[model samples]
Structures are given as structure tokens and as C-alpha cells.
Target: MTETTAEIVLFDGFDELDAIGPYEVLENAAQAGADLEVDLVTLDETDLVTASHDLRVEPQGTLGQPDILLVPGGGWTSANEGVRAVVEDGVLPDKVDACYTEGSTVASVCTGAMVLAEADLLEGRPAATHQVAVEDLEAHAANVVDERVVDDGDVLTAGGVTSGLDLALWLVEREFGADVASEVSEEMAYERGEVFG
Candidate 1:
């Protein structure tokens, strides 16, 4: 089987849990022999982006098409102004659009679904986001669902911040194996939750 790499996109004012949760989960999957490479990346080649709590995270790579492209959501979701500006005018949409064209698996956590929606990728797909952003999500996609994680073929979305971990574990189990995911969860001391198909 071919190895898969997942690129986690970080931006200014990003939520801490949005990126960290999936990062830890995917890292654990890699350690469990999933052969998954998790990369923290940003719009630029290298720079430190400030999270919502003002925590700085240095990205290892530039936004590149990967097997999976993950986007996170947080305080930036409020008013849709911040996220809209970035998604509509910034590099986030461009990067996601490119990945979509390449048939890459695109996933989002929390309000990150809004970013995808703004990019016109979620127009007719079933997706989930933070409960507070459900209306925003539904506005973009008519098939919005109320669930922890909504897997609509290539587009997978998780609800809220903490759901990212569950999404990552589900991805590992889907792409690798149940045994690998189980082992990784045990190693990380994370309990596996129900996966949405």
C-alpha cells in the first residue's frame, strides 16, 4: 500500500485544539506503522502563525497538495468576517481549491468547514461543524448534518474543536487498519469514538 501524508494548515488566529488534536492523533498513527506523515504547514514556506491564544507554531512546509488536507476552525469563525476574508481573498481558498482539483481528500475541523464552504467545495455535500456555526455551514451546503463527523466521500468534516482527534483516528482506521488505529489510540491513551460513514 502507498504511504499517505496529511497536511494541516495553520493560519493566524487559528484555534489551538483545531491543529494540535489532529496532529497528536496522526503522529500516533504514524508511530503505529500507518506510514502516515503529518505536516504542519502554512500559506508561506515558513513562518510562525499565532493561534487564538497567541501561541506561536512554526510550520514545517508550505501549503502543498497532499493525500489529505486538513483545515481547522476557531475564534476566526465569529461574524464570518475574519474567516470570510481569508477564505475569499487569502491563500487558504486557493490552496484548498488546488487540492480539490487534484482529487485530494479534504477535511475540516469546526469552523474550518466554513472555509471549505466559502471555497465552493461544500456546496452539495454533507458536512458538520461547530454547533454554533451550523447555520453558516448550512448556508454554504444544503446537506449539512448534525454529527460529530460527517464523511461525505472525499470531504470529511468534524464538529467543534475536540472532534478533530476523533476525525484523525477515523482517518487512520480507514486508510490503514483497525488494528493500527487501535494500537495508536492505546499508545496515546485516547478512546476511539463512533465513526460516521
Candidate 2:
């Protein structure tokens, strides 16, 4: 069987760790024989998005029906406002719903949960985000789950930035096997932490 690929969505001012952590975990999972492919994508095919710390990431492609869509978040300011606008304009909602209907997994990290909520994807759903953004997540009617990672069936969420790694590892365990997850964690020296179901 062909391995499924996951795409991490990047936007201007997105938190670097929010995207990089999960990327690292998934990459490690592939090395551990999980057969997972990962890519960094953006709304535009060629434009480069700048991270919160001024790091630039040029996407390989536009988000095109990815098997998994991971959204990352950062501070809400002038830089992020543009990205938020794109998300709120129904782009994310439409894409996320389409992916979900196609049996693709959806997830978010840190304030990325806020973007999911804004897209109305988290309405009345239990999810996790950065502790600092819990209020924002709640504003969209999502039950704030306090944990490094929250697995609610098809939708998963990770708390804060570094939790993306945990979320990715958990997904590997779910889609492949616990042994693969453990091996990946061992390779990265990442201790498997508690996850909220």
C-alpha cells in the first residue's frame, strides 16, 4: 500500500515549533517504518510565509486534498491578521470539511486550535490548545481539553507549541502501531507523555 502523506499548513507569523515539532515527529515515524509522508504547505503555491520569529518557509505546494491537515498558530497581530482573514473567509472550513469527508485526519497545534474554531470546525467539539488561548478556543464553542494532546476520533488537537510532537506520535500509534511510535520517540529521545482522549 502507498503511504499516506500529511500536510502542515503554514501562514505568516505562524509559530515555528507548532509546525516543526509535528514535522519532526512524522519524519521520525517514517524512518521508523510507519510509512508516513510529510510536507509543509501553504495557501499559495509559491509564496513564502514568514514565521513569528521571521523564519521563512517556502511551501512545496498549495494545500491539495491532504490526508492530514495540521494548522499551526502564533500571536495575533498585524502579521497574523492576514492569515486569519484567509482562514475566516471560509477557505479553511471548506477545505477541512472536504478532507474530513474524504476520511482525512484533521488537527491543530497551539493557537492553531483557534483557527480551527474560527473555521467553525470545533463547534461543540472537545479540543486542546495552548493554555493561554483556551479562552479563544472556547469562544468558538469548543470544550477546552487540558493536555499535551487530545484525540477525539477524527479530529485531534495539541496543546501549546511543543505538543505537536506528541500529537504526531499519537497519530502514528493510531494509524500504524504503538511499536512504531515508541521507536520514533526513542530515536528522537522524546518521552511519550500523557494524551487526553
Candidate 3:
């Protein structure tokens, strides 16, 4: 396979679990000698990012061309605004759109799939996001589904909050092997649920 690198994008009000759950799984896969590297990235110039829950994290830098580019979503908080803020701003969505020129696989967790939709990435594709926002996704012309994960070629999407773990584990399992993925899942004490295509 090609060189495996994952870039997890973070914005001002990203989701904590949506970003971190997948990070942990990919990190564990790297630790197990999977030849995969995972990095937290952002479209913002500053390295620091505040999650929707007000938790702060520092990204390495802006996004780089990687084998995987994943977006994470957080709830809409009156104070933080989370994915709503991202949708309104369109900065991160622009960057997401730029990644399509690269050969990496693109994916998202929760309403981050909405970010992909906003970027016009899901124009005629079947995708999945948080079920609560299915209407919003459909508005963007995405064939939204209720499944936990939906894979459409290079564009993959996951549902709700916890499904980030399942998506990441499935990615690891797909690129590496069931054994390596199982080990990472066991390390995380997480069950890798069914991933739909």
C-alpha cells in the first residue's frame, strides 16, 4: 500500500471525542508498527484550538497531504458554537475542499461529515453523519444514511460521537490487518462495530 499518514483537522470548536477517539486508535496502530503516522492539524494559523466543550488542544500545524484526512465534529453550544461555527466560517471547509486534489482518503466523524457536505465533497455520494443532522446533509445533496459508518470509495463518513472510534479502528483494520486492528481495539477497550459501504 501507499505510505499511510492521517491528518486530523481541528478548528476553533472541534469535538473532543470525535477527534480524540480516532486519534487514540490510529496512534495505537502506529505504536504497533503499522507504518502509519497520525497528526493533529488545523486551518488556523495558531497551533492552539478550543474544542466545543472548551477543551484546548494544540495542532502540529496546517494540514499536509496524507493518506487519510479526517474531520471531527462537536455539538453546537451557545457559547462555543462547535460545528455551527465551522459551517458559518467556511475556512476549514475550504481546506477540506483543497484536499480533494491530493490522493488521500477523506473521512469525517459526526457532523464533520456535514463539513464535507458543505465543501461540496458529497455532491452525489452516499454518506453518513450524525442522524440529527440528516436533513442538513441532505440539503447539501448527500445521500445521507443512518448507519454508524458509510464508506464511498475515498470518501468515508461516520455517525454520531462514539462512531469515530469505530471508523478509525476500521481504517486501521483495513490498511493494516484484522490482527493489528484487533490489538489496537483491545488496547482501547473498544469494540469495532460494523462499517458500512
Candidate 4:
């Protein structure tokens, strides 16, 4: 069986659910025998990062080129540290662009779409993001959509916090099989929402 590696990018002020929801779904898929390796990674040298809700997470390692790169949104609405800070710093976006160029399937959860926008990856692409950041995404020239998840070929995006689950389940189904995705959702007792491609 071919092994697929997935990295969920974690940063300071990232929403807990945005990262953890997909992490759990992928972990369950791995448990169900999907030939997948899932990891929580950071872009900086600091090891322990705090979430928006004050939840602390120790990332496995620095971001690397993975088969799937998952970006989670956090402080996009506010002028605080989170998506906005990452965008301004430009390091994360540059890394994301490099990974994408290297054939990583880029995905975003919630306002994480803003980071993709910064990388110039979502422009003219049908994507979804947190409702509050929809206009901002549009300003970046993205064709925003209303759905739990939007799949535009290699670039996938999901709306709001809970939609990360749907995005992850979709990835499991797309990469592995429907049976695996169904088994993962059933294992998590999660009912997936609609996915617009």
C-alpha cells in the first residue's frame, strides 16, 4: 500500500477545532487501516503554541512538504495574532506556496483561506471560508462558494469551524475510499455536510 503523509499546520492563535477536528478524523482513518500518516506541524521554531481559546499544543515538528497541507484559521477577524500575523509575516504563505509548487494538495479551514489567498493560490478558484472572511477572500479574487467544503481540484477549502470535519472526511474519502471515510465518520459519530466541487 502506498503511504500518504498529511500535515496540519498549527500556529499561535489557531482555532482549536479547526486543527483538532481534522486531526481526529485523519487519525481515525489511519486507525481504520488507511495507509496515512497525519501530523500537527508548526512553521516557526517555537514548540508550544497557544490556540485562540487558550488551548496549548506541541506540534510534532516544523512544516514539511507533505501530500496534503492543511491550514487552520484563527484570528482572521480581529487584528490580533493569528492568520493576520502570519499573512503579514509572509513566511507561512511562502512555505505554503513552495509546498504547493512541490505537489502538495493545499487545503484550508475557516479563515485559513486567507492564508491561501496570501499565497495567491485561491485567486479565481471556487473556495469557501468562514463567513466573516468571505469578503476578504473575494477581495483576493477568489470565487467564494457557500458550502461545508469546496473542492477545486488540488486546492480544497472549507467553511467555518465545524466544516473542517467535513473537509477532512472528504479528503479521506477522496484519497482512500468511501468505505474508509464512512467508517471514520461513523467512528467519530459525525454527520458530514455537503461538499461542493
Candidate 5:
């Protein structure tokens, strides 16, 4: 069977749960005999990056034109910066514009949806993201909603950190079948949440 490629796209100050939860789901699926391939990647020259919480990750490699591009959201508080820094930089939005096409799927978690918005992909499309980012998404002209996961065919988006797990499992169900997704969910002990279309 041909393996489906899923990339957990990372950036500096990325939220740990938003990135890792989905990654673990995909990894567990592959281990359970799913024909899937998953990796962590970034556009940066260096493989190593420091997340918002100071968790460091040396991604598997740089990105390619992946079949599934999952952008994870980070958070921020008075204590430290997270998504605010990326939004301020405005570099990643350009990269996101170049990376996606009609043939592949593009998805986001939390404020990562803002990156897609910055890339002009969310205009007139239904999407969901972290509550903190909903207004920003609407400002980007997206048809935003409050949901655990939102599926707009090739473009999928999820809310906040833990929702990454929901989106990942949903993708497994979408790519393989309900049985495979259920098995993976059971193995991971993740209760599947509502998926909005």
C-alpha cells in the first residue's frame, strides 16, 4: 500500500500539545499497521527550534510538498510570547502560501489558522481555530465557527491545543476508515470529539 505523508509543520514558539499530540496519533497509527508516514518539519535553516514553553525540538527535516500539512498553534501570555511573535514576523504566512495547492490538504490548530489566513487561504472558507484567534480569522475573511474540528474538504482546522488529537484521528478516519481511526483512538485513549463539516 502507498503510504500517506503527513507533516507536522513546526515553527519557533509553537504550542507543544498542538504539535505533539497529533504527531503521536499518527505515529501510533503507523505502528498499528496503517500505511502512513509522518514527520515534523519547519522552513528554518536549522533543524532545532525553541517552542513557546521553552520545549526544544529538532524536527526530522525541512518541509517538502506534503500530502498533509498540519500547522499547530502556540499561545502567549504576559509571561512569554508565542503566536504573537509569529504573527508579528509575518514570514511563515508567505511560506504557507507557497507550500499548499489543490492536490494536497492544509490544516491548522489554534492560532496556526491565522497563518493560513495570512496566506490568503481562509478567505470565504469555513474554518475553526483557538478561541483567541477566532476574531483574527474572521478579520481574514474566513467563515469562522466554534467547534472541536472543522472540515472543509481539503482544508481542515481545529481549535486550541488538545484539538490536534481530534483532528489527527479524524484525518485517520478520513484517509483510511472508521475502524482504523477507532483503533488508533482507543490505543491512544483519546475520546473522539465532534467534527464539523
Candidate 6:
């Protein structure tokens, strides 16, 4: 089987759980023998990124068109210098749009959906995001769903912070197999959540 390469996009003021939850799931799936490659990446060349909760992380590499490109949201509601800043700066969204190809799937965690929306990726697409950003997502012309995860073919979106785990698990099941996803979830002692596509 071919390996699936997944990159969790990191940025300053990004939510800790939004990125790490999926990171842990995919990495565990890899350790469980799933053909997966997971990495933390920044949209631009950066040494370190400070998350919403003050956690510091060094990106493994710059963002590229991986099989799965996961974007994490932070400070969207409070307008802190994270997701909102990235959205306003516009560079990250542009890069995200450019990096997406027919061979890749773009995913978002929490308000990271806003970034996808900013890139015009979610327009008329079924998606999900943090409750706080539901109206904002709708404002972007996305068909917002209340489920924990919404998989719309090439674009996957997850609700609030912890739902990223569900998104990643779903990705594992979709790409690898249900058996491998179950193994990873069992290893992590996690119960899979609802998904809507």
C-alpha cells in the first residue's frame, strides 16, 4: 500500500489541541503499522510557533502539498493574534489555496475552517467548525453541519478543538481501513465520534 503523508499546519496563536489531537492520532496510527507519514509544518519558514495556550512548538518543515493538509484554528473567537491574524494577513490562506491539488485533501480543525473559508475552499461545501464560528462559517457560504466531523471529499472539517481527533481517525479509516483506525483509537483509549459527509 502507498503511504499517506499528513501535515499538521502550525502557526503562532494556534490552538494547542486542534493541532496536537490529530497529530497524536495519525502518529499512533503510523506506529500501529498504518502507511502514514505525519509532520508538523508551518505555512512559512519559521523556527518556532507559540500556540493559543502558550505552548511553544518548532515546526518540522514548511507547509507542502501533502496527501493531507490539516489546518488548526486558534483565537478566532477572541480575535487574538492567531487564526484571525492569519486570515487578515492573507498570505497563509493564499498559500493554502495554492498548495491544494487534486491529489491532496485539505482539512481544518476548529476555526481553522475559517482559513479554508478565507481561501474560498469551503464555498458551498459541507463543513463544520467551532460553535463560536458557525455563523462566521456560514457567512463564508459553506454548508455548516453540526456533526463532529464533516468529510466533503477533498475537504474535511472538524468542529471545536477536540474534534480534530475524530477528523484524523476518520481520515485513517478512509485512507487505511477501519481495522487500522480501530487499532489506533484503542491504543489511544479514545472513542470515535460522529462524522457527517
The 0-to-1 C-alpha lDDT of every candidate, in the order given, reads 0.83, 0.81, 0.86, 0.94, 0.84, 0.91
Work out how many backbone clashes candidate 1 has: 0
Task: Say which candidate scores most in TM-score.
Answer: 4
Estimate, for each residue in 1-197, the C-alpha lDDT of model 1 and write its tens digit: 77798999988777889899999989888987888899999887656888878889999888888999999987654544435557756568777988988988999998888888877888888888888778877877547777788888898999988889889888988899999888978888888667576
RMSD of each: 1.7, 1.9, 1.7, 0.8, 1.9, 1.2
- lDDT per residue as tens, model 4, 1-197: 67999999998999999999999999999999899999999986676999999999988998998999999999987775899889988999999999999999999999999999999999999999999998899999999999889999899999999999999999999999999999999989999898898
Give, for candidate 6, the lowest lDDT window spanning 10 residues: 95-104
TM-scores for all candidates?
0.93, 0.91, 0.93, 0.98, 0.93, 0.96
After superposing candidate 4, which stretches have Cα over 4 Å from the reference? Answer: none
Q: Candidate 2, after superposition: displacement of residue 1 in Å?
A: 2.7
True-vs-predicted CA distance for residue 68, candidate 1, Å: 0.5
* Full-model lDDT, candidate 5: 0.84
Off by over 4 Å in 3: 76-80
How well does candidate 5 score on lDDT at residue 83? 61
Clashes within 3 Å, all models in order: 0, 0, 0, 0, 0, 0
How far off is residue 31 in model 6, in Å? 0.7
Worst 10 residues of 2 by lDDT: 76-85
Clashing pairs in 6: none
For candidate 5, the TM-score is 0.93
Q: 1-197, model 2: which lDDT tens digit per residue? A: 98888999887778899998888888888888877789998866767888888988888787877778898877743433533555566676677677777877889988788767766778888899887778877888999878889888888888977888889889889988999999988888989778898
